[model samples]
Target: MRRLTLLVLLATAAPAHALDLTATVLANKTAYIPPQCYTRTEDAQGAVHNPCQTCHTLPRSPNFVSDPDLQQDYAIPGPALENPWTNLFVDRRAAVAATDAEEIRDWVRADNYLGADGRPVLAARLDRLPPEWDANGDGAWAGYRPDASFAFDDAGFDHGPDGRMTGWRAFAYVPLPGTFWPTNGSADDVLIRLPEAYRQTSDGSENLAVYKANLAITEALINRADVVIEPMDEGRLGVDLDRDGSLGTATRVVFAFAPLEGVTMHWAGRAGTLGPKVAPLAAGLYPLGTEFLHSVRYLDPRPEGVTMAPRMKELRYMKKTSWQSYAELEEGALAEKKEDADFPDRPKQFFGSAEAGIPNGMGWRLQGFIEDAAGDLRPQSFEETVFCMGCHGSIGTTDDSTFAFPRKISGPGAFRDGWYHWTQKGLAGTPDLVRADGQGDYAHYLRTNHAGDEFRSNTEVISAWLAQGDLTPEKAVALQADIAPLITPSPERAIALDAAYRMIVREQSFVKGRDATIAPQDETVWRRVEQDAPTGIAEPADPWFYRLKR
Candidate 1:
């Protein structure tokens, strides 16, 4: 058939090459623009809208920027103005259409985390460091080891085969609204690990009860609200667990707006909690040394439904390597803006050692590992890691340069107060997050973006949520109760998307683009744009803070 010939031609269109595991980090020729921002739509009045303000706006707490005016523009460095993603231009419809859905489904469902011999596959790969990935020519990997066992205790702590805690704790939160949703080609999970001091009692003892209380306290501080916890002895903490003028048996960790007398928290001091100086520390500011491991995986679509594949497509790690005072954060942001104004065409340059990971300039160091041509995990090249710095380094939507943990579900309705993994409970009955304006989050996104994803390409979502090609009041109301129907793709779509991405993996063409598209995305993205120009919108959209405001 003609279809088979076209598929064969497309598959061989691009030549395959050996994996590039080099550990060289390269400077960006232009400031990067994420593909997500390309998802633009016109209002009913036919006015074009740019939603860049959603991720680029003034901070809510510790309003760090000295000049709010500078925050309005894209303000990328002059040198880094070129769009670096070349894969956007490549057409892949033939390859996607040619895929055998069932075959891709079976491949995705295959266990990738562990070998049939019962050992971690990624761990084994990492143990044998390839010469190409060793930037310094050292045979050892200097990065954090893949220690997550995927086996969790009741409290969500990852436990190894030796019955020892791996210090990684998995938590469930509503995925970020757009590209991060599972229907968009990947199923991912986030795990958090605090410093050893916070996981210890005032007496320096490793007591689980005290550790739980400390974690709850940190959570309360970040969220600025009372946090529920199982009953614990307050005497062991040696601080007023509940700020009611005295310490007693406590069931909740109460947050105090002001410092309380005789309630000095030694644990807070150890965790480097910088009590209100110029402004209150930004909401969701974690203590230094907190580490987060995130895994982006393939979607395993089945007769039943789609779930996360054990085989990871990408493993991302970030750590709060240093603490930035509120003043330091503001100064750095302002300086970047000034540079943008002075040199509108000069590309931004990043300076960091490749092996340690690139600094996001917000106290966090980010590193990542992605799949090779053979579908085995390999270290991302320097240019590959540079793709990550843009979002994490200076995004208005994030709290302390992070997204998921701050959005972790809370309140009595959440399972274990939102401390469990996705495997424990999928997003089946999770309700739509309510925005500050009291609008259902998903419904508002649909009404504004006019599509399920940023690309406006997900026809499946558009058809379901926007009956008659528009999101009516009835559809909005229906979404508030449960969002799984809107976010989860059909089994066929899932398999097709997975197969398309597998093609990119086989080609080792991540530098071009990483979007899992079944067709060429000419309409959704721009190859280049005018430097420092307005995004052709009348006004900026509201920031994520409005939705996160409790």
Candidate 2:
């Protein structure tokens, strides 16, 4: 009865935008900081009572600066090309008041925070965090980590008897929404610059050439900061929130770059290979096969019964070892081997081996790719891992360590949307291209509605849905039938709606009994085969490239 009253008071006292602190209670607070190791008090029952303050004596004040070692060094004030803005709070000060300090310590105990090493950033360290590190201005830090106290199932990805996905659920990302990443195998708009070695005409030249051309446009937009990466899992798969299906299965990220100076995107001369279509956006005519800055690919285990959202108790993090790449996607086996020791750091343009063990944490590695002139995709130089790190390495952007969410507007507004607006207003006179002062259409929405927690994603919405136990396949099919009538008739709307339904129906039976497949490999596999074993195949390159060779 006493506990219930305290909980009620805590709930009511919490700000509407504040995170639900129910999970803040320490089940075994002494386990986190051993009583013998710190100061303690003995009760009449002879039990020792140790408070959190014993080891958490480091005080974070308003003037403290975050240590460089604790943060990723990526582009600050990230690219903001779209969205509605809001007037969210921005506090980077260290906790001085006893109440603030105690509340922050609770975040550490709940596995709801993290630092550069993937462990929960100790409460003492919260004050040193940069505002970007705690973008949502919440008292506790961001980065929903999975520690021993928050253990999860690691039997996934159909590994051999000795293999287990020990770190599959430790998901994290860089919270840079301005620079967006697109879902894998979806419509790509960001492109890259191809090195001379890949542009030559030879046995495997056609696809490379096509990718080169496609990347030209991507390069143009990236340099101009005009790309916009949208989310793929919004209001889909029998769920109203984004990332409901995405956080559990499959690895996809989209980054949309918005340029300060309007961009002029268009297809290359060989647009026929990309399907003979032209689409324009903002101020550019986009041809087929356009690409983005880089891609972060991982061998996802696609585990069953795992779900996440903001402020949920059963949160998980994506482990670093499961990460892989493309564009700059090096070859498998060999690339993986090379990357094992030199993860997030490898020789550029070299293909080598990968890691083969349960990683200590998440590396957020990705296989990047770009399109060719003939509208074909090509693997990036082997060193493409750095391309992804260049932007995502920012301090405190740890939710998947990539700057993308499964869908936009999953909750009131996703993380930092409000902060972005506030920052825009704060820097109204700055000449910065990426962080230009302006307002998006959703700024008003951001001001009025908010997800209420910084460490939130689409997973929060799904958690509520799952709590109701209405996620069965039969229910999914029924919901699909129910939604069919409500779906509008427009082609664009219908396509999105249909995609969502299709994904939900397909994923309903992920773990019922089947071998899990690896995520899609980069296009370089074919290039290697064509280059090495040309005689075994009738064509050495894509049909378009083969014709070009003729």
Candidate 3:
């Protein structure tokens, strides 16, 4: 019995429960459009590329204000423009998103070009986590790669099941020659979007590419996900369910994450002019980096001694309600930016400040980290960080954003690396704050105007053909950029975006473990054939796929 006792004591216990990483497909309160292509060209590129200010000529440009359906092809995907060989004009454009444009593109450069080498040059992206994520109460979180998978599903993401890949086409960031929507899926020629000219629209009006591609923004990286089509409904889109979705709604996407920390922040309120004060922050209030009336620990909660000034007030943080609802959030966020002390250097240096209290040894590392991370994402795009960080709102459901973050996940063994979960310390769940509009002036936060040049309309330019997004690129045509119309943006595109979102989510969510093995649903829908694309592409399968009867 003594020996048995000794063995029991010495015997290692079975691994404690695995961290419950239930990567549920949650919706963001705000949605954004990824500025389609990620490239760096001077703001002047628009002129050189189009020479007519035609790319930005909205409502219409080439011929003047035009309708999306006027052409057969849709918008161009980012891939086509990455190469100057194919997109010769892209090289002449000036570098506006120079730093970020290069960083984001370089970070995933391998994904751009194909090589004879066996290794695939692509970002093996994990699940989508919030950016600006802060754990350990550090007032900041860094980015890391996660191990996750994405899949395209039919149940939730089938837009047009077994539909012929005839009329669908991929447009170029380059200009296209003619319209081709109902014909073969070929639109490499009609029109293009200026990705470099992307200005953070205050009203969410310009987030076209992000919203369209379901990438939140052009700078966002595609993780392990496969796109598919699905039935669309009003409920999924927060529309009046009673109303008929007369609009041919597209599919809802389903995404699965290995559940890494994405854009997350943990701020403890510190409200005090001089002395400590405890107070509640109002909902929908954002903490201006200014001395607020509350003591809120944003990254870490020092609940023991943390408090605002004698008259300290709570720091209220608002988050985007849904990605589709980003319009509202952007309005709010943009308004807020207009009110703040336009501190350009703040985003990169905020957390490392002495007030933020970096632990002794971690200070240097923290500073260096801020330098590197800020340079990578926020240095040129504070609003992007704010826009991203805001949505991945507070950890758990606490009245005050300050609460104890669970220390471990799985076990000490699991956390050997950075695999810790915020749930182990306590319950409300880990920080998953949402983005709020008016968080920062879009361009000011990013400081992309390093050249001291006019930053208005700094975005990438697409060839006119991509505007249609149909037909084969080889057979695609290019039109002059000046002729298109200034698009007022109708509900049709919005509805299509919602449909695309549905398709991306449902497809990914249903096939959680497949990894990035599956291609995008749109890819399947159009059978996007590009000279740059790989050959012998296999046809994708649909879950509820129907075999049409003759």
Per-residue lDDT of 545 in model 2: 6
Name the candidate that leads on lDDT: 1
Which of the numbered candidates is closest to the native, going by highest TM-score? Answer: 1
Residue-pair clash count for candidate 2: 94
TM-score of each: 0.89, 0.19, 0.20
**How many times do residue backbones clash in model 1?**
13
Off by over 4 Å in 2: 1-361, 406-408, 412-550
lDDT (Cα, tens digit) per residue for candidate 2, span 124-181: 3434543433434564444322222112222111111233222111111222211111
- Give the C-alpha miss distance for residue 320 in model 1, angstroms: 0.8
Off by over 4 Å in 3: 1-550
Q: In terms of TM-score, how similar is model 2 to the real structure?
A: 0.19
The order by descending TM-score is 1, 3, 2
Q: After superposition, how far is residue 516 of candidate 2 from its true place, in Å?
A: 38
Tens digits of lDDT, candidate 3, 103-137: 22233222121123322111121122223333333
- Cα error of candidate 1 at position 370, Å: 0.3
